[model samples]
Target chain A: MILPGDLSKIRSLEEVFLIRFRLDKKSKVPLLLVVFGVMLILFAILNIVLGSVRISLHDLVRVLLRQGENAVYDKVVWDIRLPRTLAAILGGAALAVSGLLLQIFFRNPIVDPYVLGVSSGATLIVAILMLTGVVLEMGTIPPYLLSVGAFAGALAVVILIVAVSGRVKQVVTLLVIGLMIGYVCGAGTTILEALAEKENLHNFVLWTMGSFSGFGWEQVSVLAVAGGVLLVIAYLLCKPLNALLLGEDYARSMGVNIKSLRVVLVLIASTLTALVTAFAGPVAFIGLAAPHIARLTLGTSDNRALIPATILLGAVITNFCDLLARILFAPVELPISAISSLIGAPIVIVLLMKRRTSL
Target chain B: MNVMQTKELSVGYDGRTVVADINLEALKGQFICLLGPNGSGKSTILRCLAGLLAPLHGSVFLKDNLLYQMDPGDLSRTMAVVLTERLSPGLITVFEITAMGRYPYTDFFGHLSREDEEKTWEALRLVGARDLAERYFNELSDGERQKVLIARALVQEPEVIILDEPTTYLDVKHRLEVMEILRELSRKKGITVILSLHEIDIALKSCEIVLLVKNGKILASGPPEEILSEEMVAEVYGIESAHFSSCLGGIEMSNSGGAQVFVLAGAGSGAPVYRLLNKYGFSIITGVIHENDIDYYVGRALGGAVVGEQPFEEISLSNIDQAASLGRQAEYIVDAGYPIGSLNRRNVELARRLMAQDKVIYSLRSRQEFEALYGVDGNKPVYCPNLGALAQRLSRRKK
Candidate 1:
């Protein structure tokens, strides 16, 4: 029955995908890992190559090797875009993984990374800054204050949301409350924006648009460290999270501290989303969309596969979208949120429709 | 030590108590079926045992450890639960779902270790669902879903698994399969299996012990034969029940009269005419139904008669001959309150011939409401009420 010809049979693309997918505990894990490793390299090269002033691969390599005459090109590539690109990858991955964790926790597919209400929470503080006409000596609004305001706002919102959602016991009900909280925050911001002076209003509006280009080495360093720690924490809790997917009782019966784990994981998720949102101005669907894309692609929620897949996919897509956002509007660059939404909404819609029809 | 023990357990929603109990010690590795009608706190009790809900008054003990005192992780390591809750929508595959059982053992980041993977695979194989490892959890059939759920619980490697009415919504065959899986888990794995179900006969056959829950108290708890008597079942359900023993030491409940009628019913509105015979004592009958028809099974269960070929392939044919024979003997035929379609003339002829024989045929305007009495003659002395009694008042024929 075990024929050589059968082994040699050419598998269709889908079949190949499934076969590769089936081997979660394979010897070729290193090879699969290297595939993502290569993606990181490609993402770096893309970050260098695609920008406001496009640099050819030949010119980019020569500048990196220190043989080219284009010292100015080197500064633009390495000093400016490279750090921003790295920050985008980190922010995107952080948001996405956080979103995935939250969605699974609430058992709601529509649950975004900001289920902790980081974006709206952060927006509230940003709105306050606008209303108070708070200006530091710096010509540009200090990224540090924005980051601090966002984190505090997000933490407060998450603590409240978790307390409410846990008692309600229905995902949809919790979602409505969360969305309302977001709207309330948004409503408050709208009032603040209406009352602010022209200069304060401009600052608030610009910050809300969300730009990755604003991140410096120091800001990127903080997010990279914080996001990295929580991502690891999330990976460790994969089993507990998987249990929670079966519902609160199942998780409790399995000896998982449902309340404590919920609190801890939400804290971690909040930290990830807050750090990213604080820096990138609430990058939108990266946190909400990327995890689903990774899960659908891999056909598993075992964090071993999902975490890495989300990371690689998150970074790749964010870099690609950032590239598009810069180019699509020509003179005036579009926000990274627009690029993500254009892709994210269709992908989510397709997944929803597919589930309905299959049922 | 008993695998499970409870002392004066009182469960409730918020302040009002639902399941009030004294004390009980469960024998280890026994298959226990908690039987009760709907909303009798069977689920509430199960949840308390599984540590999902804590008892308000008395303490719960699992393997002699105080339940409330145990860490949630430790409790999960010892006990597993399956409630009738829908899964969160996801792309989770069967393997991942089962591996979730290993949650208590893993670090906070839930990657399964080598031991976790082995345990999950063994659990999947134990449930005979290893082949479904790659399939999406939601894509599985009802039976497969039930098995996979069991598999997920099994991998927790718990001392006890508690399920609350796992048989609801499943067909008879699927229900049997689920029960069998539980039986195997109890016997072979030496795990104490506790499940609640509405299927009385299946519960009696599969469980070693039966716990009957009734009106905020325990009705009875003992071996199947010792507990599930006719009087007890009748008292619990308020329906007439007759017990009969099979030659092989099996107990079967004999039939009770139901409200169902098999009117070798015709198309169009004529079926509604006979339906006007709304007397509980005047029973309805079934006849010559097409195969794959909805009413065929309903007729068979109602002890109906039939005459023609019931489709054997596309549908289940149960005692069609008996149903048809009853249809043939149908006397005092009513038109079921409708004009006839191109149905078999046998029923129509029966109605016409019965009318010619001076069996009073009354016209009804949509007899569906009346059929609550049974789609039969209203003039006869059946146990319950009918239109004839009302008509007699108009005619001054009280005598």
Candidate 2:
């Protein structure tokens, strides 16, 4: 409701206005923060409320408040859906921020966690552990150990890339090396899968098709805590990462400790990729697409805004994809990667078409 | 007081030394240009100065401290580098790109304070790119992009700025624009500037001190007026001495070996004949131009032997004597139309005398016009209305 005086003030404010949706466009960063924050919360709730179980909004609130009447509904909601939803949130953000870091580090728009072979390396180690009867003591092994093994394998590839990065000055050379490493690790995983026992094959195959199902509270806690820690480290690196966008020599001239910064970027990116690969297989394209989405929406590559925006966008996208994976098939869940690629690939194509100058 | 200095520095890549023993010092607010042929280690020396590459031996000093040993943050605060590498950061605005210069000054997370933002805008304004703040960096023209890059360096608030071939791919207008901005920055801001340039003319015009690099060493370093001589340019660039004139600013051309042609021209009319003669492989001698005449500069720079008079003076007997000797020695003569002023009216007598001789006289003027100007009747010379026709007639004479 605007009076005559208020209408005149609004007309005066139009001079500085650019795009609509913000009252004061000069303070658009804070406005974007608030808008994205609200959207993230809304999407997170929408993800938890709508699944195969068809929990009503009222029951969703009751379950969230821990005062629900139905014990079976509570078990399904709290035990199954909550952890899975949380895994989607944490895992999505970890991969997204990791992708953003690699993109900045390599100065390539198409790079992501899998481009560096982290996902393939983690998959290979997990395949070896699952298929070789190494983890089957009395026919059962904890998921936590599987995550640890996946992390070690991803870290190994990361360390290898870091060792070679010093010798290679060209960014394309480093990316090609990373791709070859991915190929070798992928071939090893394929060979191991072909030789696995008949009963163990199903589990190994399921792990290969990335999903947010089967996450327990313990696994969720580890993903959350680890992703949270790495997210903070990535946030702290926003300044240097922005500097690096100008290229290494310029970054160095701007007082960025490029050598140490490269080490930290690799470690953080690899750890984030490992966390997702260990728990949910190799989730595809979220890391690559989420940052692009944030950049397009917010109109910036300055990582101070881009990092948080990417994290939130990544979490929202993965959660939405996981929800689709769960409900689209009803009783049986589809692989999250298939749905993500189905949706994420087109966004990349559209981005390429829209921003042809960048391409 | 010296702001930057290097002591016996050796620079190269991966164990091979490209440049060695580069001892030099630069005073504050000095604009120095490194002039060299391609791959003459100009970039290597600049890289060493910018601290991007460690020197193979010796050291660079920024004021009192060793450059390589200084804390990177402190060094970066004092000096910034504008590299030749093109930035392709996607979707980034010029304001954001320019603000990156505040990296060393900004707090940990790189959030810009009010003062930092002001400095960023001020830096953009300094490069006269305030309007480009919202424009994308990649979308800018080459000249505008270079300006934004320099603005990024300016926001670092450095006392010294090093640029490596900053005007490599720009057109004439844009090249001059960039040089003007750098000169203004050095003059008004008192920022010491060191840049590498391929155009020695621009370097001679703009740089206070010139470092001529060749064969992996500093060949010479001094003020441009003193050290940029015809012999020095010939030795450094491996061109003939006649091709370069430092007083006229490094104008050069290849010597065309053909017949000798004497051009009777003055008051800005002989420049084209001299250039055409040089281009068509004819040895040229241009005559009786005043010292202040524009033709004299072009003629001399293109390796033409010119008979000269004092500025605003009459054509003297000595000048006519030199012109007659050169005209008698020539196989061909071009009568370039000069105005019949009192000071240079004797040039008509020189042309009339050359025409009376057996020399093949090519006139840009018509038969009646040449006769009227030189006070000769019915002596029709070969007429060439343009330089092209003149070149064609001369080339036919060569056969």
Candidate 3:
């Protein structure tokens, strides 16, 4: 039994591991948040300045203050590069938090937006719209209609998966079912692409490859707003998510209204996935890898600390990956998915190998 | 008034009832054990009472409020549960897991208030798991994990707590320790506890009320004294060949081996001998024992044909006559060497009766020892030093 007097000794022992340079043990999470926050800003700036057209950092700063003389450089920084960099950061954070939420809701580390087929469902709808010429870039179809279609398609799969989850209690079985659904959706997408015109097929294939290039302010604002609102909802669910880590039965016993909570969690996760997939065209691996990186770095599973930590790590990593995707081939840029998978997959494999028995 | 009551509660899945027509009333501080065989719906009934499953046909009331109708927030504060299923603790610490019990009372963010933290630590200490607070939950042993789960439930500070087979995976020491903790929790803190258990002996000893369930129906509900009969256990568990001894708080298999032996025993010396003979599948008949003798309990529990006498009385004429007939029919006689006095001197006479037949008589005392102690030199009995030596001789004789 622990005496009241020994409580302090135990607490101090814990504090010994928590103490860092000038920070007390309690301030560690905030300190990590500040470090990540500042690093994220720096990486976002580096993404903007280090592209093929070398815009000096001074010129970029002057353009940002709206006092620059070079209109072409200002247009390059503001119209093209800034939107793509912001898209990478916002989309990355959204996907990462989305992954964290699904992992918590499903109580499986392997679960992510991509693994649960939400991203594939959204991609399928967007592909159908893009390949069939119904969502043409011309004035005939409002482009935002594809975003709406993606959201609806993602939500449909979310509802279906949620229904199946209620009937199926096993996590691995649900994951397998999700993979099957993704395969069916992928097959349909392939059939639609086969029937499309050659020019339209190029657009569909490019979207399928997943890139943050050509992200405009309109797309950025939508992702920012949707991602911001959904992340806040995910944050509000942190406590119940912690309870859910116990299991669905225990969560319900704790008054967590499992049915409604499951729906809400899937909705938030689907929205985050749909918003990113709609604009960035299904960037892969960020959702699966970012939350894991956060948990490993923080050495804790407290979702209150993990959620924001994941958001920052995801943004910085996505920005870094996006920068490499643009500069690696110089004139011939690689797909954002290719870079994220190349970088993220190895980190995930390392984590799994390090904790071979658990994952 | 009862703190919790269920009226004709039927619980199941997919509209099919598993355990039906259940009625129960539990007082504020009662400890109830749901005793049944595997697949008897003990866990289903427990989950139903904890409000996880909606009763198929009837109502559960908590302090006169309909359980299903009560708000979840209100229900969570009033009741907690410890299920038999093990949880994946992941990277969480024991303290964090215990603090989850305060979910209903915490703010929207689930931040632990100072009082909540104190309560969590207190609960951990109550279950003697405070030293495990900083350790990762998955790193603990099964017994420590069970204690941590109990502590988690205790942190809820609920009026009632439900557990499902909480002692299944624990060792004997841990099983008793967990039960002892629950017993103390209910008695001291006035927290009503309802748990399903497979250990009949432990349940009979720890629980105040027993609900015997079988074939998806409750057979009986009352204190273990009235309801935990050998017949009731046989019917409930469908063990036709096993006998339960509520006095001993244990169960014994039926005597199948036909080897017969008459034991000369009294006081407490014959108890272990009776058990060993029963264990070896021997059909045993023991003679001339006082009703108050401790051996009488063990002997009767193993279904031995007991030849009895009244307490403080000498061996009666009728008892010796019965012993002689039974002893003559036996292959061997066991003289357990119970102390002889003036009142019970007739026990040695019964031993002499068996020796006169030239039977292989086994005594815990040796031949010269028995003759010097009780018998005459001319009518001596073959005697072994102890039960082990006697058993060895008996096995050799069988070979």
Best by DockQ: 2
For all candidates, state DockQ relative to the true structure: 0.33, 0.45, 0.38
Q: What lDDT does each candidate get? A: 0.70, 0.85, 0.84
- The CAPRI category of model 2 is acceptable
Off by over 4 Å in 2: A1-26, A132-145, A163-173, A193-203, A356-359, B240-242, B258-261, B280-283, B288-294, B305-333, B340-346, B356-369, B375-399
Pairs clashing within candidate 3: none
Candidate 1 residues lying further than 4 Å off, grouped into runs, are: A1-33, A56-71, A131-143, A162-176, A197-203, A347-359, B72-74, B103-122, B229-231, B238-399
When just chain B is superposed on the true chain B, each candidate scores a TM-score of 0.63, 0.91, 0.94
Clashing pairs in 2: B256-B281, B258-B281
What's the count of clashing pairs in each model shown? 36, 2, 0
lDDT, candidate 2, B1-399, per-residue tens: 899999998999998999999988988899999998898999989998999999999889998799988998999999999999888987778898999999999998888999999999998887789987876788799999999999999999999999999999898988998899999988999899999999989999999999999998899999999999888888888876356677679666845656788888887888877877887788878788898888888887887788989998888988898899887888888888767789988888788778777767788988788766766643457889988898888777667
Q: Which candidate number has the best TM-score? A: 2
Distance from true location, Cα of A215 in model 2, Å: 1.2
lDDT of 3 by residue, A200-257 (tens): 7787787777888858899999888879988888888888888988998888888898
Worst 10 residues of 2 chain A by lDDT: A15-24
Q: By summed lDDT, which 10 consecutive residues of candidate 3 chain A come out lowest?
A: A17-26
**Model 1 lDDT per residue over A33-127, tens place:** 56766876787688778767889999988877878788788888767787788888898888888888888877776678765556898899977
Candidate closer to the true structure by DockQ (higher is better), 1 or 2: 2
